[model samples]
Target: MSEKSRFEYVREGAKTRDGVDIVYYEPNLPPGSKAERRMVRLVAFMLLLSGLAALIFVAAYIWWPFTDFPATDGWEYKPGNSFMKGYTPILGLSLGLALFLIGFAVLIWGKKLMPHEIALQDRHDGGSDPEERKLTGNTLAFIGEEFGLGRRPLLKVALLAPAAGLGAAALAVPVGMLIKDPHNPDELFRTGWSPEANGGKMVRMMREDMTPIRPEDVSIGGQITAFPMTADGLGATNKYADSPVLLIRLRPKDAEFLRSQLHHHPVNVGGMYGDLVAYSKICTHAGCPASLYEQQTNLLLCPCHQSQFKITENARPVFGPASRRLPMLPIELDGEGYLVARNDFNGVPVGPAFWEKPAA
Candidate 1:
């Protein structure tokens, strides 16, 4: 037959269902051609692979070890923490592959098995006629009547209870955070270095290995990261992020300078332990570790934002975005000569100040 006649034949052979016309642009395959069979297998294989990937995603999400495992410096991939390190990447790959394969399978099925054709439909620009609107409203009313809600008041009340409860539950999901306090405001102002945290006695400063640091342990013009040596014997790890303090043994000239600065600002001297001063390692601006010490310049720098704190001037912010000084941990030598916190930070909260923090 001619191309025009064949096209006409195909269009005429189209069917309609539920007021919608269904057109097919291609004829059915004769028995089973190898090419058509291969296409079918390829599409099925893609769909099966997609399903397998989805199942793997679900399994990994549920069974993978995602807990904080022992690793050097918190996040490095060591043999002990390899599973934890790979958990997130595996989840992303599995889920992404599942979604990608499903879409690919649909594309292949359409291109290989289905015919390409344009659908035509009559379009009306304005709102539906009054008759159609009336019919739609009547249909909705009939559905409501079929529910028998008006006639059965008790059933309607029961249904309303679930709807109201569900709505409240949905609202609570977002509103719950505002209502709840995740961390205590009072606790935020305190740390493991506080005297109360160590059985109402002085808390000793220790190294990362939990050994108590004596004044002699730190050399002049050098800084050592210290933590509160609590009764638990877990100095740094016990309090983790909040308890680290920079113990700087200043040179005689710098110490004299700091003493001079203290005379003018007595509150800044509250945490000074003579020549060996202790300050919070956390930055006041963004809470990045302000631990990069420049012994020559007497400056403590936060690597994250280049915030400079002059160690001689009460760890005061000398440059960058930091607006406040690093809160000093009140230090003194105990009876045994171990460097210890004399008291909690003199009323000033450490780290980044929030709206709840009182104005300095």
Candidate 2:
């Protein structure tokens, strides 16, 4: 007689697959039973919950207001739009429910609707025989059948729809971030220090208390957090968050060393007012506030990543994760003797670098 087909051999010998010996196997409610049909419908409905969740995530991510400011193209929303107040919670709940529902559906399918079987396999080494390989392939098909893959179309389609949606939701996050930043591209290159932001007048560096800071206000070997008066003084730290600066009062000797450094860029030439100089408080590494100033070592430290900038060397990174020098806010004294920025950060954008960021 011709050799039996692999599936037929396995099916005829015992209800075994691969090398496993089935000592016992039983179906819960028998094939196509009325009660079993109800279980399949229930599992199918539960599995579909994940698909609905995926739709919620994708819709909210695309259509919902996630930014306080309106788009450059002038979307109808007002500045400080509060619609996105629920953005984080919505995304969290939708994505979380999708993950949980998919898992729960699979668990219910396994424990409630699937066949119960006990099988034992003898130890084997290396690759299985050709017959065993065919048996293994058939075994997977058999398991799918037990899950109603062939006999029930509803269960098979139910699993596929949610899987595709979950994948799309996963991809939307990173792709959406790459689309645009907090605002327009031009906004990234300008700050409150820019003359345009101040009705074309130079911006005076003022303290957080909204008081204009004179050179005398900052003592030697000390620093103060400052903001452009045009940026509503320090209140702009909320609107123009990147406008905050670390205004330092270096020792006369340290100031001299900085000006004398031959390799120092021309931006630092008139960037100082006597022994006082200012740098963007935002770290170029990850935009953390590089606020911890070490007057003893003349170094500026970023508490977030420990990135250090040598104040005596034009705030260039001398240690840690930062590579780019902190952008100097070219400062000088106005006729009234209040410190003012010469221009917006010497043509370099402040804070962390982006792919489109121009070189100094």
Candidate 3:
């Protein structure tokens, strides 16, 4: 057969017409040559090293210790075995070495024993010719007939079962997430701020750890952050999300004017606690934690979008994207004489107004 015919018939699909090809060669050595024996031994050594790395990878997987995070009291996410610390790095090194050794072995075998050659083949546009297509079609048809799928329905079903099982395995992963309710889009909107939380009782402000605030923590002409002190206390993180209050100690004269000026202005629960008022720390613009207070100017600034709020009158937005006033956190002293929130914001959504609600 001609060289072209040999390539088409025997080595069909061996190489593309881009002058690239893969060849396998058996070693050839002159008799009694010590160097030839040494080369074979070196190749065997590399193969053994690759096998040893693979074994070590399996051993590490079964025995190595690993920790995902600094341990939090009861949260142990990983198995606490001794080898865990080095588990991942050892596995990576072993796998990488195994692959490198295999590649290096093949390159050495090629350089030491394989004969090299350069051959040319034809390249054509579009696709294979009609004759080649006919040949491929006949080959596929021969294989189909040999399997006898049309005559053996049981064999066809058996072959399809594994493929269907694989497809089902892929779909099963997302099934758990589909169990969530599709209808509750506004679940996050409802909170302890709902009227039912208080039974018309006051919503007292507390700290992140559920301790009520004292007027002393907030210096005169200064501000402090506070959260709702609900029955759930510090455990109620969600309530605290919307309950941040900027407790401002106003000048007595300004505080007196503010009480009369703003409708539903905050008041001191007792005789000595005058000029102390708490307003929602949540910026009316985009609900940033508006904690940056300018003591002299009495302006609260949200770093996120520069929404400036004037605290002297009420926590009213004086500049930027914020149009509404910061929601006032009503305050009163609890039994221990510590400041606490009187109630949630009176029916006002503390953040930016929705399309349904008018701008302040």
Candidate 4:
């Protein structure tokens, strides 16, 4: 049997040598009719709408109004905190509409103006023949020789230099980021809790508004989350995210139970209130702000993953994945009888165990 000719097989049902079938069509129109001209106008209109959408996309990219608060200083805009919080949504809508309009316009254009047809062809299997493979290989080899890179060492070096320089440029950006050490042992680890910062002065615990907390302010079965009071006696900045303490005023009986259980570092300071103790609010497992406190059960629940820490006895992890006990922030009273953070966490790392903190 003879092989089929590689040339054009048919005018209407043409199939290429690669076996890809192509079906051609020409739209029929009425003689000098204005209605046919209207169809052409409709096609142009769809295309024009697409062009307008493209222009709007570019304009939105250039000057769509948006506001971003500075990370260093920010308003405490929590959810449902204030109005005019639709800044994020507006930017999303404008960019989304711009893209959607462009796509819709193009789809409408194709449906209105273009003719559709179907064709079938037999699939070709396996690689090219030996002659074709050799031709391709020789073509590449000839091109390489034409460049004279094999003879001219200078040209070879020149071409290689740019590629090496580009690779180094790519590596330099990531290296620059890692060059500055984030784990500055002196600054990052230490806070105002250090005795040196306070000049032998004990640090007082303050509220979010810099109000000095008193034992009377917190109810006997309630808990108030507190931060380390700075030297200037102000609310702590973002630096003290790990320094949040849960000031819990337990019942007299429960306080006695804790003090007896913890013999070395007793919970009672001056034996006045008899049961107020402070522990780090951050979960040791994942560093989540463990704020969901249960007044009735004395079980502090982590809202994130339900890691329960008992508030009565040293904030010990009783249930869930959390392993380490919450760090106790040693507290004392100021001259005015307000609760204060005496020192930092008692050598206990606040967060998850990494390579730095080896397992015991």
Candidate 5:
């Protein structure tokens, strides 16, 4: 069919705000039909549901009980374990529902309310004519000559100054982050067991209940989860996830073997106080708790990814994906006979390596 015949049914409508001509094609069905009204109501209902979900998402984000609660304490929201337990799921569900409803509504509106029509525009084969190109170039050159940028160096510099300053300001934001140390970098390498935390006094190794752990507390071929006795009493809390350590007491022969192979380990052999040694419970692979300890094999296993650390070999990664050895907290008997940290885990940073982490 000819192009003129193809558009014969199209009616010219009012011009748009931009002066573009509006064209209407004949609808397959008459307007204001019961089916069309039902579709309109369905689309409107979906859009309204989407708006309600979006509003709920914002409200939940602002007013949801996200306050941190101690493991021992209870909150009004009944945020079992931590206040963030239910926070993330609710936010995700509301936002996801809003987005899904919006997208589905748009799809339904297009399929049901809007008509499918084909439109065509005339195609050009080549660039503008030589005369048009020359005229355009002359116009631009005339504008440039009138501006007198070449004659006015100071004006040009003044114009460029703001752009240069803006570019510099944009560049400075990220560069400033690199130079600024908001918190101490040493904090990443040190744990709550740092000797300096307790007025230069040795920080005692304590259980989750805040009771000091004696050498007799951890039996041979057994492991006990321990935390540093901090001044603020942040033991076993989410605030101190990096502070948990597995205090494994090796058999005498196993301890002797580990002592003999101390040269292979990253930290000094003194990190072990007799047969009892404490290693960071955080897995080096992905920061999961390496809590699943096997007494017979003397391996601390991370349930998340199966990363195993040899308890009798300075907690070295003997199996799974872990590349670095578990950081060993230096321990010794305090004056009162309870186990205490001589110092923080050597100089190495704990957990997974990140972009800002220094090279080993």
Candidate 6:
């Protein structure tokens, strides 16, 4: 353990040079040995596996059957669209595998291929002279030399390939999010209720069974969950999850109160058909179904967090964590007397208040 018996990699073994201790130093594999080549190849294979999994993740995240396209009738969850269920799980598994392989590759590289050394350096009272600085720089260079990248070319390429790929993926995530343009009147701001989604015709409010609803269908003070009727029923699918609406037949007194408060809730202007007022089923707090309607109280309650929206005041949040009102779906009777959206919600598509706020 004396300085004279120091490892062959060093020239002069100054025991206390620069006020540091080389307590331990050993390589897991000798530099440029045949056995070292084999270990590098093994680590390279693991890195390759990690890169392959990462590529799979990127492909599945972008091009997989993730979207419930209208042409495919995405609502049925049948043979045609069942593959969509696997999309999320694939994303999870591939990303997870990619990360796991990278981690394992790093572990094996350190334990089986890289040098094993320990050094201790005491704190300095002042900046070092030129000699100390040169030694410090050489120390870093020595660590890199221990990896033998110059002597062995394969290790360099193996490290660079996966490192570049993983770097790009990491950059794409946060950068991609920061660069998205949220201002929009279509997909982001509008929903299935928008006339644009229904070929310029009003989207009829249909029941779960696909039957159009008339004014008489929802009883007085009663409410019903309704989806929009489109040619492919795209309105009914999770593609437009925020589109499900609560068509509540407000009591005469409540309807009168709503009309009187229209000045404050201007989004509800011409938003009702007689006494029937509709609001988004998705809660403004956390996107839970604000479905539990308390008839006597005229309160729409989100059972998830006990948030309450007073129906008589345009479904404005009066309790719990919700600070914003539910988006109102404007409704009127079509020529067939079935309820239909007069237009899309007056503001952004319904969800948590923090969602998209369109510039237009």
Off by over 4 Å in 3: 1-201, 264-273
lDDT of each: 0.67, 0.78, 0.57, 0.57, 0.67, 0.75
Q: What is the lDDT of candidate 2?
A: 0.78
Identify the superior model by TM-score, candidate 2 or candidate 5: 2
Measured by lDDT, the strongest candidate is 2
Question: 1-360 in candidate 4: lDDT tens per residue?
Answer: 875532223322233333435554332444234644464455444434434444443333222321233322122334663433543454356445544544554464355433343556575588767865565455445434432234224434433433443344335323322333323333334555545445666777778887778988898888887876776453467645667778888887888877765653353233223478887787877888788888778898888788998876667788888887776777778788987666666555676633354231
* Segments in model 5 whose C-alpha atoms lie over 4 Å from true places: 1-183, 356-360
Please state the error at residue 348 of candidate 4 in Å.
1.3
User: What is the C-alpha lDDT profile of model 2 across 1-360, one tens digit per residue?
Assistant: 998864455555434435577667677767788988898888888778898898799777765653444443222334364665577789899989998888888897788777787777777688877976776777678767655578789988998768877887977764454443444445547888988678788998888778898888888899999988883343355666888999999888898898786255775677878888889999989999999999999989999999999988888898898878888888888999888998888677787755555443
Best by TM-score: 6
- Specify the poorest-scoring 10-residue window by lDDT in model 5: 9-18
Flag the better candidate by lDDT, 1 or 4: 1
lDDT score at residue 217, model 6, on the 0-100 scale: 88
Q: What is the model-wide C-alpha lDDT for candidate 4?
A: 0.57
Model 2 is weakest, by summed lDDT over 10 consecutive residues, at 70-79
The alpha-carbon deviation from the true structure for residue 338 of candidate 6, after best TM-score superposition, in angstroms, is: 1.7
Tell me the lDDT of candidate 1. Answer: 0.67
Listed in order, each prediction's TM-score against the native is 0.51, 0.64, 0.43, 0.47, 0.53, 0.64
lDDT of 6 by residue, 274-333 (tens): 898999999987889999999899999999999999888878788999877888888998
